[model samples]
Target: MAKKVAHADYHGPSGGWGSVRALGAILRREGNAGSTALALRRQNKHGGFMCVSCAWAKPSPPHVFEFCENGAKATAWDLTSERIDPAFLQRHSVTELEALPDHDLEQAGRLTEPMRWNPVTDRYEPVAWEEAFRHIGQELKALSPDSVVFYASGRPSNEAAYMYQLLARLYGTNNLPDSSNMCHESTSVALPKSLGVPVGTVTLEDFEKADCILIFGQNTASNSPRMLHQLDEAARRGVPIINFNPLRERGLERFINPQNPAQMVATGSKRIASEDHRLRAGGDMAAMVGICRLLLDWDEEARQRGEAPLLDWAFIRAHTHGFEAFADAVRRHDWAAIERRSGLTRGALEGVARHYAAARNTLGIYGMGLTQHRMGVETVQMLVSLLLLRGNIGRAGAGICPVRGHSNVQGQRAVWITEKPELVPLHRLGEMFGFDPPRKKGLDSVEAAGKVISGEVRAVFQLGGNLVRSLPERRLLEPAWRRLRMTVMVTTKLNRSHLVHGEIAYLLPCLSRIEIDRQASGPQTVSMEDSTSCIHASRGIREPASPHLRSEPAIIAGIAKAALPSNPRLDWNAWVGNYDLVRQAIAATYPEWYADYSRRMWEPGGFHRANPAREREWRTETGRANFVAPESLEADPDVRIADGEVLNLITVRSNDQFNTTIYGYDDRFRGIHGSRDVVMMNPEDMQRLGLQATDRVTLIAAVQDGVHRDVQDLQVVPFELPAGCAAGYYPECNPLLPLWHHAKESHVPAAKSIPVRVVRQA
Candidate 1:
């Protein structure tokens, strides 16, 4: 087998001509230059389909080219000319396809029709949509509702997600787990506990007014490129940007705005971060605590001098509770302990604290880096608690921003897509839907995988996303998925999950977001909520890749009708015909929040979902903002390595990849090319471990319990990372992450902070 030539170079800056070249390459490969151009123009624009990329909020007055390089790639990928027809499926066996790469499977192009697994032949044969749904219905009905798990990806529109969750609920199961469980479930759990809201309080316009913004554990350029424009503007306007992460990201260093004519012409690129602190993988919580401790000591000194206090005493007294306890805890945090845990000197943290204290309005930004840890929820709360000390929430230009990845992930949660029945009371949901929803608890992603492995889960159905590629401990999870009685995947393209067959497997082709979705009434439009909670409609402008492909809503509704023939209370078919009716039902479900959802969705810039916390009105048990005061912050207590080199393995997404989907093997931002099978470590650590760059090494999981797994043939790359911390690409390195190693409160797998031992492969 021939592999693409791998290359490495020192990555410097972001955007400029590089972005243009990347976009051009994708468009040329797509071969629909004209249509791809139009799709790119319409993306993130008013009345246009939302970009199937990151959840970055569209500006009120959208830019001429609102899409980024990766966003353009996503659009082109969805609108590719290649198609997986019946002949293609007939030629390839499931076992043969399973051995191929993730990119290869998706590159085979959009699925044209429904496919069913043939055990006798071991190939996926074309099946009618009706027949496929009927078979799934039969399998689902044969088992208990609790025995089936319905997993959803983050790419679906609000209408589709709401309908899918409703279908599961109507079928008497609350086992609704989503991509959020794997990524930012920490934010979804932590924020509401302290700030009375799960979503971020900052608006898109907050960037302009902020004096300083802290970028923690997120590569803004690769993950959310459109944010480079905002970061460039902030840097140019003299706003100090502070970055805290284990690795030195090129985006955090400097960025040239591709939209800027001057920068594109090689005038110069603006530096993004004024101060960059390379904190260890699990050191974020300790770093935050160190900053808080300094702030409190400074406040006490200011009070003794009869000068104005640094703390917002008035706001604290009026709007916050438990400040005294929190302050006491901060004062008690030992500088030595904080320094040891954070891998930063006390003076360095104090210097950063001074800058934090000087800024009138500061925005704290983070991503999966902070959330994919054992102390993820607590880490988020510490940042929130820091903001509360200065009365940042509800204020102009200052608040918390988790920086979600999916387009409608936040919206899906708002509409109630979770396993917990208490989130939205069953009685209230029953009154709106006219059917009593199941009250029993449901399994999360990890627990669901465990059930599947235990042979307790009879069936597993995925709306989107690659379960085999996204979940942790794939070596175990994949075999468990194979043992299922039935497996169904509703997707636009073939992925690794499609190859993992059960006793009975079905693949239902669905229309991509860039494709036209026509139903019984007329062409339909779906809505998605961005990171800022702005709800808008997404109407595909181009013709669909395949005529046989059905829209996601239509497929979900079809499955609902087939699965629940006895209950005629909900008209699933009629509702699917007109998505407006779905929105109307959503409005009826949450009359107070979504009173006129259908009308509001069509508004020019869309409408912002009402959040009382954003307006300074706390809805907690105390009827005010709460503060959590912990004694210490430590992530992994079981990481004991006395002999070999122990590295804190942090899983990261490559520049060309989005979650589990691999666009290409090149990660331009990190200087890694044509390969993700490598580990990045600090030069000092590499020297200490007697390893050289490009040396083959095997990474063994250093877990206290559970099955230990090892990833071999990983090339070592000495990059500018913190000592004792090594970075590896996700899905491949997911096997090293123990399933049981997760956050206590949120139950999110600790993908970012896996303790591992690195040794040269013999």
Candidate 2:
């Protein structure tokens, strides 16, 4: 039924000579081959710029070369010599530029000055900073505050995020949606209800003490490469690492530390996982339920045998509620149903349970794989329930770790960049800032897009992100974006969002993380919080790309001054002149966590924010951690299909990509080269569908929305995946995801699993 072809597989270990070669190539491509070495040495170190890559933690006593290959790419991307001046903007029309690919659009270089769209000429022309601010002010004054949306990427510093939120609140709106709304909003919503904390409880040091590590739906090699070192060390110490995912990611299989010369040159590599379980996409919840059922059964057997019970009864009685109800719900789930939903046999799930029960302290780490589904909230709660069975919370080397993608995404939420007003301290903000903040719930990413389509939202203020490319249903959102009355983007480089501009769109160039941000006082330092809740100082070592570029704080202040009425209570100029004033305000607002912020920021490795869950102090309504249960074994019952030709599609990112930003065409780890327009499928499924390797096909969504959503001209590649399951690159496959298909509670787009039918091209 199928035609056979030669398979291209990568046999090398992760982070060996391949990574070194990739880094060298990126440096040369960006024309930073000479000065990049010094920059790499200073990255993630004290008194140096933080890596603008992932939110992986840094060691206290940092290594000389603490950065990874992707980190090198990000730095080179920021420090590239290419510049987009007025002449460059004038040379190409908006229609002409929109035809270029995303990578080429970004490669056009960094913005050199403020520019405004000229509808008459269909091109962007340079404008003065003062004039741009005045026009933005006038436009804002004309529209209702509720009709404007303020969106931020995860790249902004804590001080900038705090000021940006303050500006929005002072303008009488709570519409502060951010990057977190798209990625980790499920974690934010589920963790607080389950653990009494919205963030992870474990620190970087926990890896050393963890007896067993359970990773779900995360690719360390591609998403967070710096975490490989911790896994390598844990494996060397004989810790059991049980990984659960549909794909056997290279990072979780074996790792060769580039920092270790002996390991790099050796033929062998360090084994990272003790066992890798291939579960179906969107089956994380089912697998968790299966493991919990086995643990409950084992506990009963141990109790009947007059031995110690497997579950932590003491911890459960003391620090948790609703355990009995959760256990009862687990008992109701049948093995046949679990196996059918999870695509895992009972024996495999038993092995996972055995590993989890054998260890005294276990750690659970997850990413978007679990959170980008329809039942994302319930799935996260199930994982928390699995950990609570053994009292994993608040224990050394044991807790939940939600590996965030952006460096300061969690920190942005910490500084009140959220739609839910109750999560922030409104009373304190009002008393300190001398204004009453809005109480109405604001719009999230999905809600904002829907409102934009309906002509409810008239303006958009983007801090720093390619919002057009990142959100789902790009085919619909891109055209609706142009309907806005005004759009202002404060960014470092050009992106697809710039081309899909509004009637009155303005682009304001700003300093990046690796560039100097000097104020009237002296050289200023910005703070970022890692995924581990560790906040540290980051200072730039390179000069600004353009002399006209301003810092994020300055740009926000300029707009605030021009838009709102003069307020004696707030000093915008002083905050911009000395960043310490902004830090002081942050310390005053969140005294319990950020008191003496400036002094603590200068510490060796900075300081960890206080988490009540880590201290066994429950902040939930019941005054204890809660054990929540899912209603069924199926994660997405509404979209489940029984048809043989229909497959569950999981949108993935390439090794050369981060979020929506594409660095190169090669995913060296997956053996994909020259293009990202391919779909990976199981060989058996290809044969069943009468398809072969290199066959051209189109993926059509199986939804009943009456809208035909399909991605055409995708080459099918046979890979190691479960039957009836397929994988495709994200943002490319994002078109097949309906705007209405999102998590029930969190509103995050369900990009991980979409039911699709593959139609062969003639």
Candidate 3:
């Protein structure tokens, strides 16, 4: 069916009556108006489940209604009365269901029972939980441990994530490919290299104290709606908020607090961005270079005038190293190249740089827009260097805030869920788990895809996430998945990934965070860390969508016991019975921040994980923060475009979307209503290419690879974006990104900056 497109006036401000109306529509559609409302009120509250929508840290002593519009949608979708039982599966064959859209597949509702793919009939039939585990166990026991890859998403709780990784390690493989590899792995890789820590140093409290907040490549109002409240507060306080992005997002321009009745009914909304810089796609590095170059000049000029300099010289000299080399490289950068690459006038960039120089305390916040590019790591490091110039790292209301995507992605890594064995304190983990940890580095998501294609990987297991939709190069990934001997998905709802099965496949239904998990130890609560390092408890209040569903930890335990029956060290039943035992194991493995995990969790707002970088303590090899010099500003050397009508493409999430999970076919904030198959382009670029708004066009990738990749019949909409830059929804456009195209250091797929040519459909 053709996806409908209805254009609505762009949502004036992020929130207000519009949000209230949307929330109502979602609840009514779910047919559980009363239950959904109660669930939403409980979200992010004391003794309530953390929102599974976005990882925005809940405010300390959260508000009465702490949820956002998107959170309400997710809650309604999760707590829907609809259920996918054996009868439903029997009616819909795997081949038939595979033809449905992602939204339809999930809207078919939550999976209620364990199902095994019947190759003979090409259907999924109900299988006993034990039999499903036995099949997975049989496959793993037959294949070499290294041949099995375990994929995880960021949505799972800390307890579930820890158990998932521990099971993989105990099963003798480091092949843990996670969602971070596709999203914020660049932040993880770059921060540690520059600031001596993988995580951001800033806390939510910093939002209040910051004199200025510089936002890069993130639409906070839509992605993290609760953050709009913070942004609104910052704007009302007259703080200078600067934004850098290719497209002018409404969320960055202004926001209306739905919680504030006076503001909602009185003044409409508060102006957000003091200045918005429209940098070209893949131009963040050049822009950062330009800002730093101007800052360096300002510092020199201030010194010549016998005035206090903008640079924090004392902090630089005492706590940082290699400043001269980095500053020299900044000086050597050609202004003409920076202007051309960044698509910004030198005067405009310098104007913003001066504002940055004036702020005593600044907060640098960024998202996937900056991290999903070719030089993502370099761009992140440049951001760190810019902050370090003013000693922003170790002060109140000042630090790098790489706003994370998933609920507990940071906590997942906090408990060590990475593929790199060296990053883990192996001896300590081994001591806790009573086994020798794997020494070899494992494949990330992209690499794992390649291995699957090459027949090197025989078995696949996913904890939580839509691997096929989330990963790049779906054309190649489809065939690779089919080649696997066995595939297992532990998921709560139906998704496209469930249809892409191997010869032997199992779908194990797991409980969602909004659903109660009554294990042998009674009702249990799972812990999750937010974007900021604050850790808190999440206890589901509502009953499960289905009685057949099991807790994620319990499911993992069952699989682990079945897979490694002879491994006497693991007491799966004992650990799964009581979640506190799981937290105890986590604390024992990493004694640093998690010491007394259970005791400290009861603290008012949950405790902040210890971060030495917050105190100006550089834990780098040289015991000081290092400033690395960037050789150039170009992000993608592999991109080649024809002269006629090629443009840089960035696959973005619509306001109605979250990490490959589509809530609806509407992006109200962007004026795109009831449509997911639309391309956003600058009007000038559309004119140059002989295209008009609503014109049906085919987007073909401009790469040398022989494999063809194109998404056909996309509605073209002229938007206020930089010329030569086009934006489209992700997963739909993910095919344009090849498997080999990724960031240099972090190996994250370059989904944001793809080069493509436009062809008008006849």
Candidate 4:
């Protein structure tokens, strides 16, 4: 039977009444409409909880309603009065729960207590907190230190993340991998090599002063709606916003600020992007090189005419390195190859370059589209190279902004939840904690999964994320996960990860970000670092979902205390009882960035961490920003099809989804409703394949892995995509993404581009 799919060309603006209605719908659905106004008003405000959505920066004096529709949804999702107690678990077996859809599993409601898998009954049974911790500790003690993987999500507060990593290190291993490895690890890896900073150099204020904004491969509307406000304001100020992505997203084209009463009532919208270039999937590198090539050509022409050079020659000569080699590489890039790969004409790229050259200061903003490809690191470096051509870096209102996903994903890294051993200050940590931390580098997400599959990793510890669902190769990982000796998950809500249990799996319910965390010291406040490097306080105003739920810090502390009973130097109890102690320890460990952390967090807009690149103080090996050239113009060189007909598949997140968590089945902005199992193909590609809207098809991954990686029963919908390219929602289509198909250095799954052949389903 054909799935019930709703299709229409959405003519409304990005936000406005649509967003208002969506927010109301979510609130009503969650049965939290009574406290909606209070919860929303406090979101993103000083002394209130941070929006658990994207890592977009909060203004110093935030708006009256500082939250977006998605942010509100997240709040409502967390604050839902629904509960998943012992009876709920008793009603559903693990196997039966595993069969449920991802959305249905989460929608069952928030977990109320710690539960342990009872293999005898195939259901999770309520377990005492102490007993659960003791068993988890025993399981860890039985395994080798390197056999356990401590994984963290982006949801944890700075204190929780710090303690989580500390717990891993105390357990005598450096095997700490977190959500960043999957999302923006490319940026974290590439930025330091190019700009001497892992994070972006720009602040929220930079958007106000930017003359030109270049957005690459990011759907600002769906991924981070708060960013739309910044883009809308920039557009209103006549800033030339150029967007480069396969889809001409409504958020980039136009937005109606729901906060603006007049605009909402009038049903009027403001133009966002001055130009939207629909590039092919995984073509960011080629498009960027083309723009750089044009800029260099213009500079050469200007120099020949005895006019002022278009490039920032003085800045390049003083503050950067490898300009000659980078320029030579750009000049040698074939224009035809660039055009073919980017699916853009020379004239179009030249126009964008012209706008870039005309602007004194430009902000380069990108998302997973540029970071989840095989050449993600090189692509990010190429963007840095583009900014280097005009001295965009280290200048006011100009820099590379990798819009991060989670509110505290950047914070987790800042507090040292990394697989790289050298990134953390081991010597300082030892002095502070009186324990010799592990020096060996650990496995990233991909390596960790491989280890799990190989039976090398016996246990997995997750901090608030659906690791199994978020990762690629769900088929391989999920079964391998069940074979593990132990799996511990500290989360607020029920997810697929809980159902896919190990031999001795434990589900530890923890307090959500919006709940009051009353510790021995009093009602505690957790701090999170925004994408802009501003560390601020997030105080939960709502009541806890259940009395049994503990704060993330408390859960981590309990586990660490049970695991490392003799470690007297590290006061796990003190840290949990008083979060200020965690901040003090964090301040001591990384004094350069977090000194006086607690006091600074209370500042009007929080405190911005010191980014050496912003001051032109290069921390690279060469002591300067490096213009690294990519080896090839193709972002995914291995993405080829030797078969009859193939399309480059780009996995996307719908407006109703956040990472692996599905809020609803509707993608309103794209006009997709009542279904997520659909592939969006270009009109010409659909015709070429003899397919039409709602035509059922199966996408077979074009790989040499011998294993069949395919997603069947995907309905086709015609979209304005480039030829030979199709888009599908992520995780649903994640089966087509092989575990081996990841970025070269960063190991981030190349989910943005997959070579696949589509066969119409009869």
Over the stretch 1-762, how does candidate 3's per-residue lDDT look in tens digits? 346566655857778877888888878877778978977888988788888888887887777789988888889988887889999999989999999899888887889999999998889999999988887887888889899998888888999988988889888888988888998999989988888889899888999999989989898877888888787888899999999889878866877788888887795788899899899888888998999999999889989999999899999999999999999999998999999988898999888887888888999999988888888898899899999999999999999999888777888888778899878878987876678889999888888988887889898888888988888888888888887899899998889888998999999999999888998989999999988899999999988888899999989988888888555666889888899999998888887889999988767678889898998888888899989797888877676544658899988887777788888888888888877898899989888888988788899988877989998889888788998889999888988888888998888999888889999998
Q: What TM-score fits each model?
A: 0.98, 0.98, 0.98, 0.99
For every candidate, C-alpha RMSD to the true structure in Å:
1.5, 2.0, 1.2, 1.0
What's the residue-level lDDT of 33 in candidate 4?
A: 83
Candidate 4 TM-score versus the reference: 0.99
Which residues of candidate 2, in runs, are more than 4 Å off?
1-7
lDDT per residue, candidate 4, 1-762, as tens digits?
Answer: 436788888878898888888988888888768886688899999999999988899998898899887888888888887889999889989888888889988887899999999999999999999999998888888899999999999999999999999999988898999999998999999999998889999999899999999999889999889989899999999999999999868756778898898898887799998999999998889899999988888889899999999999999999999998998898888999999989999999989989999999999999999999989999999999999999999989998899999889999999999989899999999987788889999989989998988889999999988888888887888899999999999988888888887899999999988889999999999999999999989998988889999999999988987888576667788888899999999999989999998999999899999999999999998999999976688888888744548899999998898888899999998999999989999999888789999889999998877788889998888888898899999878887889889999999999999999999988
In candidate 3, which residue pairs clash? none
Model 3 poorest ten-residue lDDT run: 1-10
Q: How many clashes (backbone atoms < 3 Å, residues ≥3 apart in a chain or on different chains) does model 3 have?
A: 0
lDDT of each: 0.85, 0.90, 0.87, 0.90
Q: What is the lDDT of candidate 2?
A: 0.90
Model 1 Cα lDDT, one tens digit per residue, 483-539: 889989999899988888689999998888877888899989998888887888889
User: Count of backbone clashes for each model?
Assistant: 0, 0, 0, 0
